[model samples]
Target: MNEANNHVFDTTTGEEQHLSKRNGSSNGTSKNGVANKIPSISEIKAAIPNHCFKSTIKQSMYYVFKDIILIIALYCFGHWVLQCNSIILKTALSPVYWFLQGTLLFAVFVLGHDCNHGSFSSYALLNDCLGTVLHSFVMTPYYPWKISHRHHHNNTGNMDKDEIFYPIRKKDNNKNSFALFFGLGFGWLAYLWRGFGPRQMNHWIPRHAIFAKHVVGCILSIGVVGIWVGILGYYVQLMGMVSLVYHYMIPVFICGCYIVMVTFLHHSDINLPWYSDDNWDSVKGKLSSVDRDYGIFHDVIHTIGTHQVHHLFPIIPHYNLREATTHFRKAFPQLVHINDKSIFPAFTEMFFKYSSQCIVENDAKIHYYK
Candidate 1:
């Protein structure tokens, strides 16, 4: 058989496929006896255009401008709602107004995330400056989050130690089945309070030192909240707080769920392989991560869906991720495609979808049964 046709196939499905090799390689022949090459992360990054690797000052400015516009628009909506006191009108308008507010907040989070990667600006300092302001406005500590997030990127699909969303192993899968449901509901609170809240000011990164220079920023935020309360009186503050909770906090929680669920489904799928200590390397660990096609939301929130490319060249700005992703897709057709349609369905399936997955192989074969 020709080299390309040497990988195995399932005749019943009538498509080319490769079974995971017992030795953690795709070097085996298919049922049709075709061979396939699974390109490494370096190989994929090398194949992409040079421009895709570079972030620009102009792009950063564009994101900052967009964020400003979103914030202003949200403020206008909130003001309009506050002016109207009719119960029916307020009830009906509240959800719509909050949806817009939540979406704007999500955009703010995306911009901050871009800055954290140093992809929002050509100047690293500028990115840090803007990121700190944007994150603090949203109640996230910029430097603290940036440091932990960097670790997450460095170890994307390592079964034993990915910094965030490390999947549960069979032995460690002691939680009752019902726990996953409650956990999903309260996941953001748990993530922020347990994982990030206490550690905010304690991390080694300078930005995380909130009690130092950033104490002023925290006090400023409190002052703004207090001033708004004083102007509108206690009842207005109460209503405003309710509005913020429903609009900002609740939707932030939903977005967090969306992020976690997507990340979990990406790496936790039945077909993807994870690595153990012996076989783990940065490139292999990242390639073990999957990319999803998030459809139109890709443009609205930025192209975070092209995650493999993000992992490969994190310096590449979100604007150029799609270009890099296209390059890799051409070179590696067998690469797993986890588009948006798969995400919600996977969430519905829940434990059946991702309960006991591992990154590496057992006795040379990719272990799926956990």
Candidate 2:
């Protein structure tokens, strides 16, 4: 380890603080006024073994195999439930089946994300091919999402240009308050429709190229549903639509809610600091993300709990996140951990906490405040 490794310190409150000379900040003072140092990238890297960074071909294959099995199981179970003639049995199994289906959808989303980062496979083309298929199945435009998602990673905590889900500053708080209520009820609809509206004409999405390549895929999805409707007849079609409303739409709504809520909680904490362009750099930007303890769901959904590591090395496979997080924790103890206990409280906490907050600086110190 270099001299930079000497600056790592675990705070009195058990939070990790890693100091690096590159960011031009020597130490961060906690709420208690105790100054803790941050660790350099080299120090963080040295703490982990060389093997942790290496992605094996075998490990990649394992993810592919697991994903295929889970998808088939989910589809087979859903088909069985849908084919049943007994209304009572179908009704009873609807929720269970939908939950299973949603799990499979979530896995698909994860695989697509991994592919976007080129972490799903050793070959970039193979990753893109798989990613496009998985993403289209879920009605997402692969290339569009991939491009925008890269912007999100590049500017995770920026207030002005972080692609999506950037928090409202103090001045924009009232505007956001109105949007929040409106968004809760029909946000997804707005998002989908926006692609066809004048908003798409803006710089974010070009006018002529609204869906572009995605138009074919979307039409294909509709055709598949149309064929199913033809075979099943009106009542079955109605039931299928109902099933979609309950299973697919409702769960997607819930997931979107969770995604927004969790993301707001992650970066909008009172303690975490957001930086202006002048004060921000790669190291500081990576440090801007917070970690959460997501319970057993962390394992099932992959290491989303190790968010800081994911921000630091977006290309690193989810399997390696835990090990990277362990190494990072050893160096910088101030890293946040929002677990079930923390998250549950956040339901009420979110309303008051993030409602009017922004990134502000005072006396050469940065903080998030209302």
Candidate 3:
């Protein structure tokens, strides 16, 4: 393979049609006597137009401001509507407000996500500043999440090392139900409280396994989140507990649900493959993601469902994902898999279908969820 912009490309072989038939003697090469040509991550990056990588402060800030404006406007509107004193009207509208507000908050999280990738701004400090503020507003610890999320991106489909959404072992019964119930309800919070996988880390603890490398950053993240919680506590004192629950807690809960649902669907699919560390390469691991279409909410929540390319090139701004994805599909048609199923039905289907079988045998080189 030819070298490109960021790094030199290695002429790597891709996954075989029958990966099980191939011995594990060679890395990135199929020993099954079949030719399987797949592009390297660098090769794919080169395929995307250079413009897609451009993330201007104005454009990025525009999205950040837009989401904030919508969220504020909705909160104000909900506040006014809550005054009507009609129990029926309030009951009908509260859920709608929660859904819209939650979705907009998740959109903010996506922008923070871009910031974490250093795609929100060319300046690293600015990215950190904005990322910390935006993520903390959504009650996530920015640096701690940034650290673990980097690991997640680096090892998306590697069963051994993936940080979040690691496949559950079959023998670990009822984990699926727990994942479905708790993961759907307060999964993100639980993850922050105690991480997933064998390590079972806590994102807030500076001395945790993945966290020890950047203890200072982790502490700063915790401090920021603590400040946010303090502000929320003061808000409760001023606005009363009922108002706090109605206005903030419920909406945040909805956003958490959105986070879990989108993340679970993005990685866990019946057709997606998981690889042993020995068999995993950047290209194969990245391709394991499923690009989804969320209809009207696509732009509302920032095309986070355009996940395949995002996994491949996390530096690409969220705004440019559609264009980058178009180029990506054209360049490597066979590699692209977009799930066009509607959001709720798709989540339901995959949630149940793969819930019990996401686990793989310890010795399996390549595994797919049943």
Model 1: runs farther than 4 Å from truth? 1-40, 82-89, 170-185, 196-240, 340-342, 350-352, 356-370
lDDT of 3 by residue, 10-112 (tens): 1112222222233223333233221147787788888899999989999999999899889989999899777779999988998899899999988998899
Q: Rate the local accuracy (lDDT) of all candidates.
A: 0.57, 0.55, 0.77
The C-alpha TM-scores of every prediction are 0.72, 0.70, 0.87
What's the TM for model 2? Answer: 0.70
**Which of 1 and 3 is ahead in lDDT?**
3
The 10 consecutive residues of candidate 2 with the worst lDDT sum are 195-204
- The ten-residue window of minimal lDDT in model 3 covers 2-11
Give the residue spans of candidate 3 off by over 4 A.
1-35, 169-182
**Greater-lDDT candidate between 1 and 2:** 1
In terms of lDDT, model 1 sits at 0.57
lDDT of 2 by residue, 1-370 (tens): 3444433222212233334332222335455222345556677667666666666658866766786687677667767877789899989997777665555565566667788888776788777767776665554555556655676688766554454444444443333242552264154334433521112312224233534655554454345435544544554466667656654565455444544444455554444555555555565656666666666555655665567777777777888888877776655544433233366564445446554443232322344533
Query: Over 4 Å off in model 2, which ranges?
Result: 1-29, 32-37, 79-93, 170-240, 243-247, 335-344, 358-370
Q: Residue 76 CA error for candidate 2 (Å)?
A: 3.8
Clashes of each: 15, 13, 0
Better of 2 and 3 by TM-score: 3
